[model samples]
Target: MGPVRAWRDEEEIELGPRQQRAVLAALLLNNGIRLSNDQLIGMVWDDPTPSAVMALRTYVYKIRKTLPELNLKSRDGGYTVRAEIVDDCRGEPLEGLRSAYFDAQRVRLGDSRLKAREDCLERELDVLELQKHVAAFPLRERPRALLMRALYLEGRQGEALDHFHQVRALLIEELGLEPGPELRKVHAQILNGDLTLPRRPEQLVPDLIDFTGRAEEIAQALRTLPGTVGITGMRGSGKTVLATRIGHLVKGRFPDGQIFVRGRDVANELLRAVGVENPVGDKAALWREKARGKRFLVVVDDVQDAATVRDLATPGSAMILTSVRRLHELPGVTWLKIAGLTEREAREFLRKAFGPVRADAEPEQAEVLLERLSRLPHPIRVIGGKLSSRPGWTIEMALLQMERESRLADVIPSDCAAMMAPLIAAEKQLSEPERRMLMCFARQDAEVIDSRKAAEMSGADAGEIELVLESLAGVHLIEPLVLGRYRLPRFVRFCFGLRTAELTS
Candidate 1:
């Protein structure tokens, strides 16, 4: 079902407009099946016009006229095209095709091709390839089972079991069920040595287990793909985590594979992924050549600047970039900002960490805790995990310490060292004046601080403070408000407070 084409012997048949071709693809994907006019229209058009039924008829007529070798019949008010299906799946299924229905078919076809490719392998298995399969179809037990076998064969029994746990957690959480029997059996086989072995997979980190919320943003970013999507947020607000989730969901949409670039050596990481090894001159050109005629994804995490990867986000495939900066200058980019979790989402994180019963017992206290944490994901997760681990502590007990807490650092759990890494790295990127202004923001009590207030606090010229404010706003340390006002986001302010407190103490 890859790259839909019709041929009579050595001669290839021509197709019509994209919509008409879409009709053909739908018919081919569901070959020899009875498709009513409504079905065809629904698959090909999002908002079918009044002439949709007529248009479907015309497409059918054109198809029959163009390729008279095949049978295109209409009976009982339904259409059917009879032909022998051919599938090498050389490239993406129906490449250059974009439609929700086509997207679904592409995933189905991609999975089938993956299975076929695995079956043909004689001795060795490419674990990475199977990982992509599992990522694309997370709930599909077949890929997970297959992955288990591959891992077991490679003597990576521990990793195989880890994969099992990841999938089982996903199943129980997402579907309110355990892994399917087939999947459990595969896990049993691996654990008991009866068998083989297997998201957010292959070059990407596993998505956060308690990836709480951001439903609307996720949907919008996904809808904006086949183009660039920029997710900008304050440090530790879960930008990378959201991008990774999107990367997993769109894994099937891109047939080639997904490449994740996190640090320096971006050129090498991308080039080598596509077999353009040791690319010397014009690596961009080589990348373009490889990207052309293929569907893949590039998820650049925590990008420092938009210009750095402007050329890489070209037309060949989709890109998702997570940055603390706004990336306002990047062409053809749609930006989504993540400030922090909603109160509901924050509570959900707590619920997951401490179990629903405990979390619900003190909804009032939980709300107070959420306000104090500012609903930022990383700190919430860290703090939630911390409180969860110490069964002796309750939400109220934690609140008591926070209420009288002078050094915010004193309140942080000792085990949450990793939580500060993002902030520390972000601090390194800021200029001295910007860093000074950020701490000034921490010391201020105002909700929205203007340049004058910053100047008053820092004892700097108002004009110079304005520049610093703009810089901080550019990187999203402070969110710009109307009439020249700005807010140091709750989480960043909290972190700055911690920094200030530690120094003073």
Candidate 2:
């Protein structure tokens, strides 16, 4: 009687003695199926008694009298609790008695009815709860798929995709396997925008809730001539943030959709964004077809090479590529170089990030903290999040910690290591001379180094050094100053110095 209890309306009916309960349970178990007199006797008493049949009869009579609604019928020299009453019974069957079968039946009932109830807000909530319950079971794809469908139907496509990714991540992490094809099919359907919902202009890029500056840059990117605009900046220079802000502002122009791709597989990401599944031969061709006549905005973020920009770019669609490397000049591609925030912009960023209380109480300390951070948006955001989470720590304490700890890991959040990983990877791809030229800046006292100066330090050809410097600048590893000189950011210089020390020592 654990999860199973007999209830007659508001009253709980007593099922009577042990033998009587056993008999009632047996009839309920074989509900609608007649149980022979011999079967009932065997079930009632493990060892048949001379009077077991009579005892069974008595139990049946008592159950009938106790619950008249059961319609327990004696037929073909046997007894059966009618089939209709089984549906009304709330509790599960006795242990080892078709529990698996019954549970599946219940799930099927819920799943089959989900589509009918999706249009009702109240019913959809109930379906969500039921789907959540079903998803908790192992190897059950139907529930999660239905949940995704239900969410899409409710006009929460982003949440739907998010839920699928969570499940996919968990499965891959825990079991070393991907979700089943059924789930992938449902995901493809959602991405394709098959569900009939009003097409409101959607901004798929996450909101920059604490977005601080870049007003002029955002305006320029929005007004740029119709073509791909390349945004190059040092790692964590707020290129992606600025691009996303531009996407949101110009989303009104692209009524079809706005897609943001962060992965290396540009073709599949674009296809998936617009709802294509398992694209076959000629990925670029397929991308063009799907994007044809669709005035959408595509923001390809964290691009490492020019080929990706070329592959993802579709004619007639506005494309924004954010990268650390300067892409090889492609036709119709205008470049936007992002620099660190100005003094005023940096101060306002810190004020907003640290909140008014700290900014107002210690204006000088805030300024000192921003200066130590080199006015870069990434560190400011990372350290700002850490400070906000720990109210006991002040801006001055953070500054002191950064000064005392020279290692990037010690000064910045652990996740910042991931942001720097791409730059490190890009460095690995360079030739020995190229890498040496960039490392010379780390060994130099001056912040700015010209091609001739770098050639003198590294003993490489001045023209070759110039090319390396240009490559480095293209990737935003070093900043290009006026008069053909390049300078590394203080943070990048520090990182390079660390790498140089490691190689030498």
Candidate 3:
């Protein structure tokens, strides 16, 4: 059934089968465009003979007569569907509602990388309810994808995985074609937790032109006395961005000396043997060697596990450790948490990215550009990159084809290697109970949950769960929200979630 509605304050009219079919064909073909009599005739009926023209007029007359009843209009010699007749909410512009509608759909579809899974699942349920009730509406590929994503995000993992497999199988059996790599990747990402915390390289480089905002936060972290300062945030929220930016900003302050090693390499040295037939005493050995030389400013990014991060920070050395998990053990470790970008900041970024191309021609293009970019810096960067070559794309057209032409992940890197080290660390430190707790949250939709609730969900006690959360938190695999709450950053969440699910499932 198509989703359609008629307007109030107009005569009520019902269309016969032929008239409904003809009008639907015309509306779909013209879609916000003007269509002439001949164009309408051709779209409605393949070829109109002398009588065919008359037959076209008969159908057109029926549609036209029904329009007043439905408040539709044939303006400028072309039929235009009236928004009033759509039965959608009033006062609010249809475009605004449509944008919200699609955004809700985007989240529901789990394509909205910015929002957490819990939020997306809620939206998916709302959209599914709408889908069951709406009538006389144009169908689209988007709504179908939205449903699939909703199911996937709703923690219906087996069902979601099966549906994607079924889609792949059907595409092969019916269309004799393979699903596109992007679709396959999305399916894999959702099942494997890749979509939750896909990587972005721009987050790592502080000097990059794209790194805007977070200056104040970074400055404050750098100004935190002389003790060990730790920067933590949700994945893709810019912990490393702030840390790297602070390092560059304060490099002059620490001109005497600086030492930096990423957590992964640091952990490798700490965990394994160094010389043949001899075990590496502790990973801290290397850091002890490096800091022994001089006064240095040490910056370790993605410092997973407390032991690994602690090795790099000598008492005298100025050190900064960036991680998604919470590190409370480092006696003087000052914590700085990064939050999401404000709507205004995200909008301003889109304007800057798309402003140049639409400078003279269209003032409205900026709004269109902003809408398409969805206020995410990484995706906005990609949109800007694509528009750099073709300065002529009207904002509307560009946005409409945004998802159709490319998956959002394609614009952003998928490896997220810097973010994955914590998971590796967490895996290394896992105890039987901790492993069970981590796997429980890893497979669920919520990024973070209360410890009591998590323990309840996992059939464990608070004391038992705290040890796991703390252990995971120690290595930067998960972060503590307040007293009992903990959250997973997308990066570590993605890798470990997959591993956790694979192991437990």
Candidate 4:
């Protein structure tokens, strides 16, 4: 009952397009039951199109033409499918499709899959087997709760409690929600030492879907697996997104469970997750003791210092750290510097993300729009999502409108805008001189700033300007270049340029 597919006599029958298959799935999941055109439309589309009924009929016609063996019938002003639903997979049911009906069905079908796994694991009573099983369904909370209970009962209480923290972090990271009552209940029982035996883990839930680009970076990182990885980039360069997507893909290598930790308290979170409740004495040693010999992954987001997370990467595991600026090295840590998408990659991203851009662009017109957005994924997603939803808006039209707006933020729909969280965080952490230096650099309309010119503009000496530029570069607000110059990213200029005007006007 996962995803919409038709199989006759063990050989899979071709289901037409996604919407057509959804229509079939609705009928079959409710087999022997009929649904009206309106009901099917409601189930099929998140926001139904105007000619939904006619389109549904066309899909039904295609389905009938494709599979003539089935007794799919039209009656009572509706259609009904008369076949049993059957399927299997270790993925979110209807994994890629998004709709309210699919969301409801995903929850229902996911619970059933969870129950089936629980029954089978209960029969075997093997923790090792359960660990492997959980690796396939990492986002399923109930099974993870079951796994935690089993670990605690097997005298691995520290590992069990550590998993509880991992679950808590994972839940917060993915869904932006706290653990549900059932999971919290199991955790409480574990902490109180009243846990009973039970079983299950996989996929890191990713924020970026059908992600494009970063092939070389992903391949290089994957090649050097089971070691610390540092993915550093400018604030808007998609550092965390790339890390999480890559982390989700390579989860099977670590069966002990992949832990995602963010914020300043990395050491404490790791220490707790590794089951050293109060490792007040020799905390690093206790952390090493707990994390040692366990094959797992630890992803620390927005990290500042390398030393803070260096020791957490014990043997037999991997770590992926995402930060705005380049970090100091840890032993065996492979570093990847994530820059903006190449022009070709940017064009492909725009074409894949928004179809209007798929139409031929006049030479350099699309580049104008990309220059404003800096070819960064965050800004692209922001403007690209708005453009994708409105097919009538061509790249030329968008560029014209963007020029009309006083600021990039003005043209972008408030609802569709990128969070710009990383940018704001980086701004808040800036020192006074760094802030002024950034403002001085941002105020100029030029793409690149000469050091001598920046010093002249800021009325600072050569030495002071150099230090300020170095500080700005350290925080990644400005990038250094050949010949004592710096390049300010277009998106950053679009953002702070307006602020610079307001401050200096």
Candidate 5:
């Protein structure tokens, strides 16, 4: 439970310890269903102990004594809290839980009998409460849809349509997504003054088949409403995919439309989305004027300068920007820096990209392959695509080839070369001393480098080294770590080392 206390009539019953609270929560969540001793132990402790079952039994005893009204019974080699007890619960069900999943369950249980019951007003009040809970999760659509249906059934068509528009705008402004067919159909029906409208044909771009992981990042970006959220990561770290996925997720909110454009063509794309053909006046001014009243999700990807970010970020619209470099100059934009996938996420990605049969069959080989790819999603997907397309190729063969290749360019997909080229060019544009500092980082064996040590290696003053490090960090070539230390990705360091070696040779 959230604050960890139970109630019996007007008296507050104490539930001891966090583990005890967890036990109560697990039992309450599965109120009518028996949870086995092992399941309860697992729920209480991330790593269950042999004594965990005894501890669980003790907790159950305490709970039983505290709230005798709750008919907590042991049956079928497990425990269950009866549904009747839950029904009689006076205060909120799982009041202190505060978890979105628990809140959603509460809403589901509340509305479960709505169709069978004749209490329309009660159902309406439930919908209102559910809406309040759901407001925290802007990316979710089902609850909003339910609210629309409830309002429509109550003959409040105007309010239903208003709700639709509000959610639609929120979706656009927050996620750069459009309403799904179900919501669209409801809107159409409301507009036509008819209770029933045939489901509108779905209009959507095909989702990335190899897309995996970053669910949390996507959710965070979605939650940043009415403000710019920037996604920055190393090249090919899936920043664009994340931004695009977010755009699709929230597209329904922006009923006006979603405009996705590269850094160079933001002005053109905004104009195009707003249906401005061959505008004569200042494009930026015209874009702001046109976008002032409309709800649009503006995605500016591969941003090369602060000017593009400033130009596309209109006052009324929501913006999502993706770039290899950080947009430090832009104020009020929340930045989320993506990194390589965890080993688990990488393994799952491999399983998804390559057929699970092959990927799972050779687990050791899959591990080796993920290591070779550095757990970067783009490289994993690329290699997975290659292995999948050629049935004769095995994970072992791919791993062997990756090990033998002297250069990352040789091991990775050919397209990765193009992706790295811009970054290399950016590095080339740096001053001689700055380039030397980066080269020193490549030569070092340590994972992190500080300005003092970098200066010693590069034969530059510590002051100059610090300034160059900040510049490199701004462009996302290096990551600033704790206490002014900097870390370069293994792949980037390797590439720089190879380039340095080639130049000297």
Candidate 6:
């Protein structure tokens, strides 16, 4: 009615009370159609006298002056406001000025469902309610983000972009934090201005994988001050898997990031991976350079020495490294050698791999099988795979096979031996009596023993046990438990045990 009004707002508009009431009254009466002089006078000032007509004219003049600036107008003897008809084929209004209409609708409806008497009218209101929720989303990175979305919907692309940038800059200065990942992706899309929207998969929520058995020890380590976690264990003893899983739990709070690196005392293998061929002693510098600019969740697996790992960690990056030995001399790095998977996780892994064996499918047999598997993931997997192929095989049958190989001292593969080559070389540097004591202890069947008992078994003096255990612990051959207690990480134990047994034989 008023030149097909483009939806617009006055850049700045302030009106006195009388002017505001008078203009609002006219717009309400003449939503799109024009209001004649007499009609305007009756609407704005209820008096029907001649001066009332003059007052209406004065109000109309002031409104007209402001209206033009916002693209409204008066023509001939009447005042008219423009109505925008969106071009939508299905009668669903196209975005543009209609977005302002939607925004107003959302505000009016709020959270309440609109009700109507007629079924058709009720259906229409329902559609408007849904459209309001979709188009006028309340959560955004900032208020200006919402404003930008509104303007973009209203076909004011240029203004929307300007406002978006202004908001981004404002947030950057106001909060030191950068825009979140979601906001960054949204901004990139707006900058591209492609109408196509991306649909991302809903994130899968996390569930706790049952880590029964070691709960107390793991909890104690996790609760330790400074949050530095160190894990050492044999290959295939669940050390790597446990480190990764725990790192994930710890990283939620350290969002600047966490790092995991597979470390070896022999740094050359990894040095080659990070583009350091012929790496001189400056490997840490090369490593730090590679780590620069990335806020990472880093996992260094196969760690052989604490010093090597400390050298690789970029401070401020929470780090998790795995090794088969403890490096006690390396200060500040928290030392925690990971234990084998508890009886439960190991059994679950077996059940998953074996596709439900008689032990799980048959409750009477479950306990018997769990005992035979000894709660070690590698052995459990091997045995489970074997059992899966031969369903009728009894747990006792698998136990016999496990017992034979399990007692064969150390049976680590040559490739795994390659992983510990540098540590092996470091062991050679130990004094002969220390080496012989390690060899004798390595040949023993048990995985853990007190230092005094170890000395007795190796025929060494009790006083000498502490000093030798300290030296071996430094090179990571074994880890001390308490004052006199000590245990070997599965892999380190297996490797050394194998070596010690072979040498003795």
Give the per-residue lDDT of model 4 (tens digit) for 389-434: 7877777877776554434433343432343445656778888877
Model 1 TM-score relative to the real fold? 0.60
Which pairs of residues collide in candidate 1?
Answer: 147-197, 147-198, 148-196, 148-197, 148-198, 149-196, 149-197, 150-197, 151-197
lDDT of 1: 0.77
Give the per-residue Cα lDDT of candidate 4 at 145.
72
Cα deviation of 130, candidate 5, in Å: 32
lDDT comparison, 1 vs 3, better candidate: 1
lDDT, candidates in the order shown: 0.77, 0.71, 0.55, 0.74, 0.72, 0.54
Write the residue-wise lDDT of candidate 3 on 2-109 in tens digits.
223343468544655653455554564345666676666655555456675666556667766765443445666666553322312332221221223333433443
Stretches off by above 4 angstroms in model 5 are 1-206, 389-392, 407-435, 443-446, 501-505
What C-alpha lDDT does candidate 2 achieve relative to the native structure? 0.71
Q: For candidate 2, write residues 1-505 as lDDT tens digits.
A: 2233477778887877666777776677577888999987766566677888888888889988988888888888999886433333334434222334345545654543443233232223454574655555545565677677778887888988998898898788888999999789889999998754323235467868878778877777776834788888777788888888888777767766788888788878888776677888988888888776457788888886666657556655788888776666666777888877988888888778768787667788888777655688887777777787888888878766654443433233354444345456667877887787666677563588787767777787877777877877766777788756977777676556556655665
Residue 148 Cα positional deviation in candidate 6, in Å, after optimal superposition: 23
Worst window of 10 by summed lDDT in candidate 1: 194-203
The TM-score values for the models, in the order shown, are 0.60, 0.54, 0.38, 0.58, 0.55, 0.42
Better of 1 and 4 by lDDT: 1
Candidate order (lDDT): 1, 4, 5, 2, 3, 6
What are the per-residue Cα lDDT tens digits for candidate 5 across 1-505? 2344666677877778767877888788787888999877766676676888888889999988877777899988799896433344345555555444556756765554332122232234366664664575556676676667667767888888898989899889988999988788767876777764212222233468667889788788877855799999776688888887887888877656677777485776678765677887678888888776556787787888888657657665788888877878888899999878888889999899879999998999888767655577876777788888889989988766544433443233354444345446667667887677777777663568787877777687778778888888876677788756988766566556655655665
Candidate ordering by TM-score (highest first): 1, 4, 5, 2, 6, 3
10 residues in a row with least lDDT, candidate 3: 197-206
Tens digits of per-residue lDDT for model 6, 1-505: 1111233464445443553444544464345887787666655444357777666667666666655643456678777776433322232221121223344433443322221112122222243343344245433353334344445555667876775566567667877556566456545666778533112111112323633345554575566423456676534455666666666566554433343344354345444544457877777777577555333345667665556666655554445556666556656667675545666666666667566546566554655555533445655555566777787887667556544543555564443345345446656767987777766665665677688677777677888888887777755556678888777655554445656754555
lDDT of 3 at 175: 74
Query: Candidate 3's C-alpha lDDT?
Result: 0.55
